[model samples]
Structure formats: structure tokens, C-alpha cells
Target: MLEYLPILYSIFLVISLCSSIILLIPKVSLNYVRIHIGVLTLPPLVALLALIFHVDNIIWGPLHFNTLTWLMAVFVLTVGLIVQRFSVHFLVGDRSYRQYFSLLTLTTAAGSLAWLSDDLRLLLICWGTTLLGLTLTIRLKKEWQVAKKAASTMGRYFTISWFVLLAAILWLTQTTGYWQLSQVMTQDSLALLETWEKTCINLLLVISVLIPAGQWPFQRWILDSAVAPTPISAVMHAGIVNAGGILLTLFAPLFNGSIAQIPLLILASVSVLIGTGIMFVQVDYKRQLVGSTIAQMGFMLIQCALGAYIAAIIHAVLHGLFKSTLFLQAGSALHHDQPLKKSKKPASFIGKFSGIMFGILAAIGFWAASPEDAYQLISAIILGFSVSFAWMQLIVFGHGRIGRISGLILFIAGALVYGLVHTGFHHLLHETIGTGAQPSIPAFLCLMFILFIGSAIGLWLSRNRTSRGFTILYLWLVQLGEPNQAAVESHPKYLTQYMSQGGKKDEFSINIK
Candidate 1:
């Protein structure tokens, strides 16, 4: 019975691909395609429920259906459903609608294959297929030069990422003689390798994950990909790009307690700061969203680096849901955004002290929710920072008693959700795919200190942005982050005409292009 579960989604993918090909017929119509997509979503949802109900790995041949893989399957199918549904209405008049749907289904299938495979070589192949699907999707609108540039840039990066992952897989197979991920992860292969070889392999895997995730130097590709259709954007942000977190989480055994963790941590931290800094300066909504995603990916990587693989997976899933919805609803900004408020001075000493108390509560909540054996440093620092940031913002920036109370309630609620979800995922992964041990205490403490210092600096800057010294720094960040004015000015006349008529290019603001 358990062995059969692995083939269920494979059957669905075949049905979907056949349906997609059939729909390409001019007389077939899109109503059937929409219904097929809805049906396609059921297998993953059912598989996820089965996994939740039965706490055991389902391994049949080269397929592995674990808690993490099932969860990823659900995510991929959900994204496919949403994107296909959106396309039903969004691409009603587009000439390449059939091509888009075909690629969408293919991409979803590839993603499923990547997550569900127990074989490292098969995972690499699936991942590469997924990347190819994304590149085609990005270039869906062949006439759009910006889309072409974005797709070209992403293609180059994807190629590099593919090679890196391929190299990592080859090295792993050669070193351990194990093609099965389950077997490979169980052995301490790193211990058997030389220091240089270990570092090289880990670094390759890190870049392979982070580059596709739109971190730092590679972020521009994603930001530029805004020219792709909104449906593509929905799937890209929601399903495809989030694969990096899943990749790192799936390979937690590679880095947990290893020397490679520190470099990955530093890379993640830098991405978090720089990506978030750019978000603050971007006036364009899509650019801001891209920046936000970069920061979000960085944060997820940080969790992975800290031996908090469960937290990273949860973050990726949640972020995917939110970002997909946002992309789908990008045209209706009037309904979602709140009016901006003016900045104010920092909180008084008494208010600051209150924040400290809230921070303490946050720490307690996180500690209580996590497994007893889990790493303490991450939970402590996250709880402390959440409390401090919440307290400061609520006390100083919040409008009144009601605002402060609401803020506190939200923080408490968030902490509870964080704790419960993290615990569930952690337990699930522990049973299905064993995680790495916690980093050394001293290393954990160092991370905590660094994060808190960053929080402190952010607090100070928020309180005194009007000061000339800090103002200069803020201006520089804005200048560095803002989209090029010349590029915006050079928007093609034909593209603008198409956009004005409500074409597939959903982002239409004059400032953003």
C-alpha cells in the first residue's frame, strides 16, 4: 500500500501532460484545462495528508516520499493550480496560452520529481528540467526585450547553478559510492574527505542553492524578470525560486555542525542586510517585492545555517503562499496597502524596558515550542530580537494603547505559530530525514551577538534617519537600489501600448516600467 503512493503523483503528471497536449487543439478550449489543473492538485494534497497521518518514510525503488518531499509536492501543486487558474482569466487573449500552460505543468512536474527523488543524480536532472522550464516561461513573451534580457541573464545563472549542483552530486557519488540520498546523508562523508575537498563541495552546493534563490549578485536576474507575465511571476516566486531553501533543508546533513556552516551563515547574513536595505529604498512595488523576497530567502538560509532546517522549510512554504497571492493580486493594490505613516523618535527608557519584557516572553515561547534537543542559540536570539523589535516599534511607533496591545497580541500569536509549526516540521523531519546536530555553543553565541548588534544598529538608524550622518548612508542605499531611470524612460512604445490595453504585463506603473 505504501509503495503505491509513490507512483500516484507520477500517474497524475502523465494525465496532466496528456491533457495539456490535448488542450493545445484549437477546439479543446480552456475550461477543460482549468478543471484538469484543479484535479492535478488533489494528489499532492492527499499525499501530504497521508504523510501527516502516517509518520514513516515511503521508499519504493528510487522514489522517496517523506514529510519534506510530500510538503514540497503540495506546494508545487498548489502553485500550479493557482497559476493555471489565474491564467484562465489573465491570458484570455494571449497568443501563446497553450505553450504557457504546457510549460507550467511541466515545471510543476519537474519540481515534484526533484523533491520526490531519492537518487541524487535524478534530483539533479529534475532540478535542471525545472530550470529549463523557468527559462522558457521567463521568455514567454518573445517580443519583450526586457523579458529576453531577464531570461538570458537567468539562463546563464541557471546554467552555472546546474553545473555546480552536478559537480556536487558527482563528487558525492564518487566519494561515497552512494547514489541514493537517504544512504548518502546517513554516512559522514565529510569526515572522510580532506578539508579542501569538503570546503569546495559545500561552497558549490551553497552557491547552487543561493544563486537560484535570487540572493545578492544574482538578485538582479529575478528583479529584471518582472517583465515576465504575472502568472509566471506567481509561479516563479511561489514555487520555483523557493527551491533553494528546500534544497538546503533536504541536504541538512551536509552542513550541520560542519566547518562549511560558518561561510554559508556569513553569506546569508550579508544577503539579508543588503537585500533588506534595498527594499527600504525601492519606490516601485514590484522591485520592493523582489527585494523583500531576497531578504526572505536570506533569512531562510540563515535558519538552515543555524541548524534550524525545520524553520527554514516552514518559512519557505509560508513565504510562497503569501508571495503567490500578492502576485496574483498585484493589479488590485488599492485594496491591500495601508497608508504610510511618518517616522518618529525612539521609545523612552520605560518603554524600552517594557520591550525587554516582551523579548523575554518571546524567548520563552520559542524555547517552549522547540524540541528539547534542538539548538538553543537560534531560538534565544530570534526570540530576543523579535521581542526587542516589537517592543520598540509598538512603544515608539505605535499610535496608542490599542495599537500597542494589538502589536503585542500579534507578536505573541506569531511566536506561537512559529513554535508550533517549527516543532511539527522538526518532528516530522526527524522521523523521516534525520537532521544534523546543533553547532557548537560558542559559534551559536557568536551568531546571536552578531544578529542582536544588527538589530541594534537598525534601531538606531530608524530612530535617527533625519541625522546627516545616517541620512547620507540611507541615500546611498537608495541610489544603489533604485531601478535605472534611463531604462524606465526607454520603455518600448509598443509594449506601453499593449500594457495600456491591459495585456499580460501587469506591472504598469510609470516609475517601474
Candidate 2:
């Protein structure tokens, strides 16, 4: 019982259960939702503070309760509070407020549980429940057709992912004959898993990981679900999306040898490339952010697959915090009716210039320090640049002129720096591939070349300032309604359909009766 303090500290469950009950009460009012939201915010902060003070004693069995989990919990709670505050303004007196708060609490609780869960079963259950809660919250906003569709799609995706996870767990239990995570992580357990049954379990595990991490076909749900409200979007990306990666980290030791490493790397790489490309074409503010989340998650997964568990976890937390903040800001901007336009003259040129300079410094540092792994490092740098470029393009398309130019400049510079780092790293790797050679001049040259090209492109593109075809194509695709001609032609049909569906007649109503 004492061992479960970390799990118990999850404030969301209490809030969710109580909010649901309150919603059903005859006398309860919309104010109850605000009360619950307020209630839900405390547990995470309390737990985080507790963890920080007692950093050493929080461990329970396989779960190590420490500053990292606490920090993440703090972040989740902070975001939820901000979201709730914003939502209150829009949802004042709205009857569904209780339902919304309930779902929000549930989502946060699920995230906390996933972060704190010591076992795979507990983690998986929490994750699936969180996804379900998010879907239900979206469904509750039935007035928004787009939100409804997004919810439906999310529901299906989550259902399939959880099913895969369950199957994997079952397979693992059958092979190991134990459900405890500690048993599974042992050398004896791994040796037992070398059998045919265990092999099947491993395959299922991989599939399960792919599903939630938004790899391949399963990724569409994430994109579709971005149509949800801002708070929901932030929760999903920052909290829910972090689940699979956290699970992978918990079970990293189980994935030793080539069997797990090679396939995982391949999947991560594929997700990174495909997700980044798709993001480049997205125009909607939320959808572009969602694609960026997917791409970043892929990169995190790649780090995990490469045995860089620490890096992956750090990236996940950092990305979640930054992305959630951005989403919130974007929502605020939209609410204020800010004009999201493309400026002919790029904004933030100084910032882009600074980023480029920093990238150069990083590339040089890596070249001077580690010559042997230069190639792999260089590849990572290039990949990072490509991803950044795609993300910038997304921002530009969604927000227009100033956003577009600033994002483009930043992306171009970032990408170039990444490329330089890759070049230097690659050269280093080649020099030390077989022998134990140290630093190499070739790596430094490669880094320099990458920086030069990146800087040159940044300068050239900034001056050129031509509207790209992709931007126009994206605008057409994501524009909420048809052009004037289509709007005119569809108006009558739309009205007829609405009337047929028993929509309430307004002042402009024509009485068919």
C-alpha cells in the first residue's frame, strides 16, 4: 500500500471520478466543472514537489520515482491549468463543462499513471484509458463536425493500438509465465524468450510499439485528431503521445541484441522521414503541429533504438513542453483573430542568424571531440535539418507572411547546421571505423562545408522570396470551405440537407408546410 504512493499521487483519477459523479447529480451546475479542474491541478504539483524533496526514497519496486517523472507531471499539470483557464472563458455556463473537465482530468491521470507505472500492464492500461478519455471529450463537442470526425478516428486508432499491446502482453506472459515487469527484464527471462513462443512475443511487442508511436498507417489518426480543441490537442501531444516512448524506455533492457535494435531503428527512421514530409504539406495550424509531434516522436524513438534511452526521454519531455506551449499560444492567437499572413520580408532574421552560428559551433565541437562516430552524427544532423525544414514550412503555411518567412529562415539555418554536424560526424566514423583512430581533419572539413552550404542557402532564399507552389497547394487543400463558385452552388443543397435533417429554422426559414 505504501509502495503505491506515486501512483496514488495522480490527481486526475480522483477528479475524473468525482466530476463524472457530479455531472450526473440533478442539482450540479457548470460551476462543478471549474471546481473539478481546480481540484485536478493540485495532485500533480504536490507529487512533483514531493518527488523533488524526497528524490531518493520514491522508488517502488521496478518504478523509480525521481525528478524526471516529477518534472513531467509538473509540466502536465501546468498545461492543464492553463488550458482550463482558457477554456473557462469560452465555456462559461456551457452545460458540457463538467464532461470536459472530467475528460481532462482522466487524460492527465492516465499520463501520470503511465509515467509512474512500474509494470507494463499498468502502463498499457493507463495509456489506453487516456486515449479513450480524449476521444470521449472530443465526441462531447458534437456541435463541431470536424471535432466529431476527429474523435471517431482517434477512437478507432486507440482501440487498435491497445489491442496490439494486449496481444503482445499476452504473448509475453505465455512465454515467460509471469506478468511482472521485473521478471521480464531479467537475464533468465530473456534466455527463456529465445524460444519460438518468445520470438512471437518479441514481434508482437514491436507491432505494439509501432501502433502508438504513430509509425506507418497508424499515424493518420494523430493527424485527423488534431482538429480537436486546443487543450485537447496539447494534452494528446504532450501527455498521450509520450506514453509509447516511455513504455519502450522502461523495457529497454529487454530489447538487447540485433533482433530488437535493427528493426526498431528502421521503423524509427521511416516514421521520421514520412512524418516530416507529410508535415511539410499541412496548412492547418493544429494539423501541422500534430505532424511535427509525430516526426519528433519518431526521432525520439530512433534515439531509443540506438540505445540512447536518456536522450530519448529528455527529448520527449522537452518536445512536449515546448510543443504544448506553442499550441496554447497558437490558440490564443486564433482566438484574438490575429492575421496569419506571409510577410514578403522575413521576420526573425537575427534569430535565424544566431541559430546558424550556434549550429556551426556545435558541429565544430563534435568534430574536435569525437572523430570516429562522425558519420552517424552527421547523418543525424542532416535528418534533423530536414525535419526542422518541414516544421518551418508547416508554420509558414498555417500562420502566413511573417510566420512563413521567419519559420523558413530558422528552418533553413537549422537544417544547414544539422547537415554540417552530420558531415563532420560521418567523416569521423569512417576514419575510426575499424581502427581506434581519434579525431580527424576530414570530419571538420565536412562540418565546414555543411555550414557554408546552409548559410549560403539561407541568404539566397531570404533574398529570392518567391512564393512556392507547395504553399498554394497546401492552402487549397486545407481551406475550410469551397471557393465562391462552390459556396454558391452548395448553399441551396446545404440548406436543403440541414432542413431535411430537422435543423431548427431561423429568420431566413422558408416554410415548406
Candidate 3:
């Protein structure tokens, strides 16, 4: 019965994809399609539960029904289902409403299929289809020239990433003599190739993943993508940008201990800092969220670099759920009608001292738990730093003694929740996801120490408003976080063209508002 889940999951997704095509029919009942897609999405989530109990990984035809693949399949489809359901009402009467749902569902289903597939050929086809579907979905609001420009920019990046991935896949299969990804990535197959060959292929794979994850040098697309509708932004952030972590986890064996990991680490680390700057500097709500995503993705990739594949997957899943919710609630972020109140400011001298002390203790405790592991050392620094930040922001800075106490309690509870969630995912995925090649301790410790000092110095400098370097850095971040000129509009010039072209009533109704 457990073995049959792969077949059943595929059937459910296939049926959903085909049914979405029916949604493209103008006369079809959109609500009916909504129910159909939503209902179909639930089965995969259920399938995930069953896979949790089934310890052995099953290769049912093209799919390797491991917990990792099944979990991701459930995640992507769940995000798609949410986005589609939200769009059903949110985008009503707008032009291309039906088309949006169809393409979204197509993209989601194809993405699920790609992961479930073990055959390299099937993965390529489904992966390509997913990209195409997303590209088209981004263009759904074609009447908006800005949206079209965003879609065009996205398409170009997707093409480049896809090609790089294709090249890597072809090279791997040709060298290993196996079209099956499960086989091609195995230690025996990897040993068949020379060291240089594996490194080159891994490098190519890294390049491909970076492009889609919105890492530095390739992140302009995500900033430009703010011109898209909120739901589109949600799906892009939630499902598509997670590709880097997913792909990296899948190919962790090939990536582990490769020299390529060093470059990936460097690039991703830079992206994290840059993304942090962008998030802080950006005024636009959507762009702020975009920056946050870039930062989050960088962290995910960083986890992958350290051979913590399962942890990276956990990050991707949580980030998707949290980021998608933020995007969907973007409109609510700025409540213009709400009264601006000046609240009592907290006494922060004591708070800052307390926070710093707590942070140091937390860092030491975390490091003690995994003193020998390079990745865990980094993780400890991050966790401790995060706890300190949260402690200061929530408890130390609370309005009064009572408020501070409440916040302190809440903070502890939140920590416990995080620990539980992390532990659960670790146990669940440990069997299917292998730990990749461990990184060198001396290199990571030295690198982290330098980075920590640099960050401290940078923060101190940033506080000096009169410094030329500070001003230049601030402006650079603001500019980087800004949307492209093509994606910006003083007015909907398309409105005039749309009206002139005699666009339909319903479309005009939404546009005129």
C-alpha cells in the first residue's frame, strides 16, 4: 500500500494539471476549478504523512519516493494551491484571470513531477515545463507594460539557469553512463570520473542554482519582479526561488568537499550581507520582502555549502511558508487609515547590556553542543546572534517591566518551538538525505572569525552618518533594492492603450480603479 503512494500522488497531480487546462476555457465555472485544484493538492500532503512511516525508499518507475522528494512535492503543490485559491477571488474580473490560475497550477504540478522523477530526462522536461509555466504566469497581466517587462527579465534569467543545469546533467549522464539521477549521483558513478570532471560539473550545477535563487549578480530579476501581482510574487518567492536549495540538496554528494563549495560559500555569504542591506534600505513593502527573500535564500545555500542538506531543505520549506504569507499580506502592511501613535520608548541602556551578555552566553552554549563541526559552529554563531537580536527587540525594549516579563516568556516559548521544529525535521529527513563531505575546521573558523570582525566594523561605520563611505554604501544599497526603470511607472500608460484597444468591461473595471 505504501509503495502505491508514488503512483497515486502522480495521478492526483496529473489530474490537477489537466483540469487546470479546463480553467482556461472562458465559459468554465472558475469556482469549480478552484475546488478541484485545492482538493487535489491535499492528497500529496497526505501522501507525505504515509511516506514518513514507510522507512524504505521506493523506486516506483521514474520516481524515488523518498521522504525528501515527497516532502518537497507536498510543499510546492501546497504553495501553488494557496496562490491559486487566493487568485480565484482576488483577481476576479481582471484580464487573464483564468490564464493565471492555469499557468500557476501547471508550474506547480510540473515542479512536483520534476523532483519525484529519478530519470534525468524526465527531470529536465518537467523542470523546463515548470520554468515555462512560471514565465507565462508572470506575464498574465500583459496589459501592464511593467509586468510584461518583469516577465521578460525573468524569462531571460530562467533560460540561462535552465541551460546551465542542462549542460551539467548532460555531462554527468554522459560520464557516468546513467540517465537516472539516483544512479548518476552515486559514489560509484562519481568515482568513475576524474576529480576535475566532477568539480567542473559541480561548478556548473552551482551556477545554475545561483541564477534562480536570486543570489548576487543575478538578483536584479527579483527586484524587477516586484512589478508582478502579489500572488505571482508569492509563488515566485515561495516555490521558484527555492530551486537553489532543492537542487543543491539533490546533488549534495557531487558538491560535498568540492573546491566549488568554497566559491559557493563566498558568493552566498556576500549575498546575505547585500540582501540584508537591501532589506533595510528599501521603502517599498514588496521590495523589502524581496530583499528578505534574497537574504533567506543565501542562508539556505550557505547551509548546503556546509553539507547540511537536510537542514537546508528545512530552511527552504519554512522560508516558503513564511515568505508566501508575507507577500500575500503585503497590501495590509501599510495601513494608511490607521492613526499614528507615539508609544512610550523603552529604557535601552540596561537592555543593550543584557542583550549582549545573553548573546555571548547563547553563542558559547551553541558552540559547545557542536564544537567539532564547522557548519554547526557557524550555525551556533547565527543562532546566538539571532536570539540576542530578538531578545533585545522584544524583551529588553518592551514598554515596561510587565511588558518585558511577558516578552521574556514569549521569547523562551518561541525558542522551544524552533528547537522542536528543527529536531522533528532532522529526524524525519535524516534517513533519505545524506550528510555531504564535511568542511575543513581551520578554514571555516578563520573565515568566520574574519567575517565576524568585518561585520562588527561595518556596523560601527554604518552608524557614522557623516562618513563618506557610509553615505556611499547606503545609497548603493537603496539603488540596488530599487526596481528597474522598466518596471517603474508614473502612470499606467497601458491604460490609455488598453482603452484605445477597446478592452472588455470587466478588465476596464479593475484597471480604472
Using TM-score as the measure, the top candidate is 3
lDDT of 1 by residue, 1-513 (tens): 655666766777778778778877777755666666766776666667657676348787777877778888888887887788778767765667778888888898889889989988889888999999999987877776667677888899899999999998898778877899888776575456667776778788898988899886677677777667888988888887888878877777776676777766776776777778888888777777777888889888877877767777888888999998988888886544686757786678888877788788767765776546445546665667767886687544677888778877877687688668777767766665555577765556556666677767888988897888678878876775654442343665656777687645422121211
RMSD of each: 4.8, 9.9, 2.6
Error of 2 at 323 (Å): 1.8
TM-score of each: 0.86, 0.68, 0.94
Q: Please give the TM-score that candidate 2 achieves against the real structure.
A: 0.68
Q: What does the lDDT read for residue 260 in candidate 2?
A: 52
Global local distance difference test of model 1: 0.76
List, residue by residue over 340-388, the lDDT tens digit for candidate 2. 6556345366545554555555556555564555344654465445454
lDDT string, candidate 3, 1-513, tens digits:
766666677677777877877777767665665466666666567666656676257888887877888788878888888887777667876667778877887888888888878998899899999988888887876778898998899899999999999999999999899998889888899999899998899899999999889999899888898888889889989988998899888888888888787778878888888898899888888889989999899889888988888889999999999999998988789988889978757556877888888888988888898787778878887887888899987897787799889999999999899989999888888988967678765446545764686598678876797898888988999988887887899988877886797756653154212
Model 3: per-residue Cα lDDT at residue 214: 94
- With candidate 1 superimposed using the best TM-score fit, by how many Å does residue 70's alpha carbon deviate from the native? 1.1
Model 3: lDDT of residue 361: 90
Candidate 1 wrongly placed segments (more than 4 Å): 1-3, 188-192, 335-352, 364-375, 391-415, 440-453, 466-472, 483-490, 496-513
